[model samples]
Target: MPRVADGSIPGGPRHVALIMDGNGRWAQQRGLPRTMGHREGVRALKRTIQAAPDFGIECLTVFGFSTENWSRPAEEVSDLMGLVRTYVANDLKRLERAGVRLRVLGRRTGLPDDIAAIVERAEQTTAHNDRFLLQVAFNYGGRADIVDAARKHLDRVLAGETGEALTEDILGAGLSTVGAPPVDVIVRTSGEQRLSNFLLWEAAYAELIYQNVLWPDYGPEALADVVTQYRNRDRRFGGVESATARVVG
Candidate 1:
């Protein structure tokens, strides 16, 4: 991992989520096919995955594909799916060797059977690794996640298990990311400031960092900057801090 001029990130977040944007724009800027940008973005993903453990991050969730992404040109979508297959086929063993557990959080109904099979196989193979949990939100949408969880909860209630008195814990249990820690910080690249339907429920209190850097160009140094910014903030969670407690020891 490449280190910044300074030492390690101070008080880095435990869980980080990323909305990787601007692949198409990056490719357009370079006079290359958009598919090439996606290809390069994969390289960036590899870099981030390798660097996360170095920063002591326990979990990293990346927005690989959203439900809305299906609306893009069919050719582009197909290319993205091919990229997914390539990543799993080419990198799964390396990821497992590095102690990274792979998890996919999304509805798999629309994925090609072969692609879905690869996802399942990758998850099963990496299930025992514990150094870090890497979640790829492929074909995922925050609102869709909430609705799916709610439907499951309602079904349980109707089946005489528990009725109408659902709490956050009960609801959360049905979500795809039930056991994972909530996102601590969310970074959106490509100068976009919107969350774009990524992890709405889990990111309720997450500090967000928007960067002008495109996804294909993001590296460990950019990630370190996000961590540095997170460390500088005073996270009071919604309460006023005691005067003495507010002072840094």
Candidate 2:
């Protein structure tokens, strides 16, 4: 692709997703508790949110806690839940003031009552904001999301909502990320290369970038580097090459 005058690609990704990994390893390397690493990771999340708009990203999604995480030690699970409460209590006001709509994508049925309340409040409070979107995937799994979406479609059909058959659009609209844009790029930290059941359907055409930096160490520079790599990717989306691709090839 030809570079723009500013030495950057024009019309950069509008949506970026991240798998923030290596927190426990980062703390273990420092002889600190894993919880400490999680705290620092929260700081990195704040920095990323502040920097995303600068890169022309309108929506940022981060995988926080996964459904499979419940199998970890009880203490760690409790700590993770605590972190969710603490993050919302500390950041909700600032996030609302900054016009960042926060959407927690995951199953709510199994969430603790208090944490569920906080999630509801955060989403309701910022429902009117439109400046940016921050989607946190907590207690989420890509396979589970797909199952939930399928159930939703089946329920509608049983309720006689429509006689039409299920299609991609129909199923997609039933996903937790219903109104959100398709992910443009998915970045995994700590050099991990797997999706880890994050955004399965939404990432069908996303550019995947892996970074060696640990989650606590991630910031604007790391994301910027990811975007740079994303720019060089030739995204064909299962179609023929574009005019730019032909010229560059």
Candidate 3:
């Protein structure tokens, strides 16, 4: 219930999106296989999920794989696929046990059948849990998501729904994260400053923070540090402070 000096809400972000980058670089720097870095990055994600509730963040959306990642070397792509399989096989139960709702976003048409099945199973297993939300963006791209939403919107218009009117709220509701709040903070590891086609629409007003540490090195302490930065920001939503400025001055 506390208000910031600028009369803005002073609290932790409700939704946090993480761009987990630099896995390959982390492995190369240590003369190890790139897969090893990905393995460690998954561990980092586990630690962050365990620590997210403590930070009061309701939703945690992570960029695991992008649509463009398919262009990587075949061997590396296969390694990534195997890592995802292992993580789901071994960690699905752990996530469900912790009351974390799982949602896998993006296209699945080209994925292997078994892998697709596992994705569905994970979502079904934790569908009822409401304590926390974890969105795994596999094969996801921001432009593609917007295109998909636009197509769905067209269907409604052709059906004579509401005089064919279109609005931001209506279009956003058609995306994968229909019921969720907008992204509040976007954290990119390995010092990446750009969105890289991850959650472009949802991150319209999110506070962007680029960390120098690689994805594998990001842990609970790093998450806490970034969250502290979020809490200190003055979110005015394009409005300037009026009475609060006079009172604080």
lDDT of 2 by residue, 1-249 (tens): 344565434646779999999999999999999989998999999999999877778899999999999999898889889989898999999999999999999999899999999999999999999989999999899999999998998988899998889899988988999899889899999987899999999989888999999999989899889777876788888888753365345
Candidates ranked by lDDT: 2, 1, 3
Lowest lDDT 10-residue stretch of candidate 2: 1-10
* Reference-based lDDT, each prediction: 0.88, 0.89, 0.86
Over all chains combined, what TM-score does candidate 3 have?
Answer: 0.91
Residue 208 lDDT, candidate 3, scale 0-100: 92
Superposed Cα deviation of residue 117, candidate 2 (Å) = 0.3
Q: Write the per-residue lDDT of candidate 1 for residues 102-176, one digit (tens) a residue.
A: 999999898899989999999999999998899999999999998999999889888888766877988788888
Error of 3 at 131 (Å): 0.5
What TM-score does candidate 1 reach?
A: 0.93
Alpha-carbon error at 115 in model 2, in Å? Answer: 0.3
Best candidate (score: lDDT)? 2
* Clash list (residue pairs), candidate 2: none
Candidate scoring better on TM-score of 1 and 2: 2
lDDT for each residue of candidate 3 in 96-123, tens digit (9 for 90 to 100): 8999999998988889898899899999
Each candidate structure's TM-score, on Cα atoms with residue i matched to residue i, is: 0.93, 0.93, 0.91
lDDT of 1: 0.88
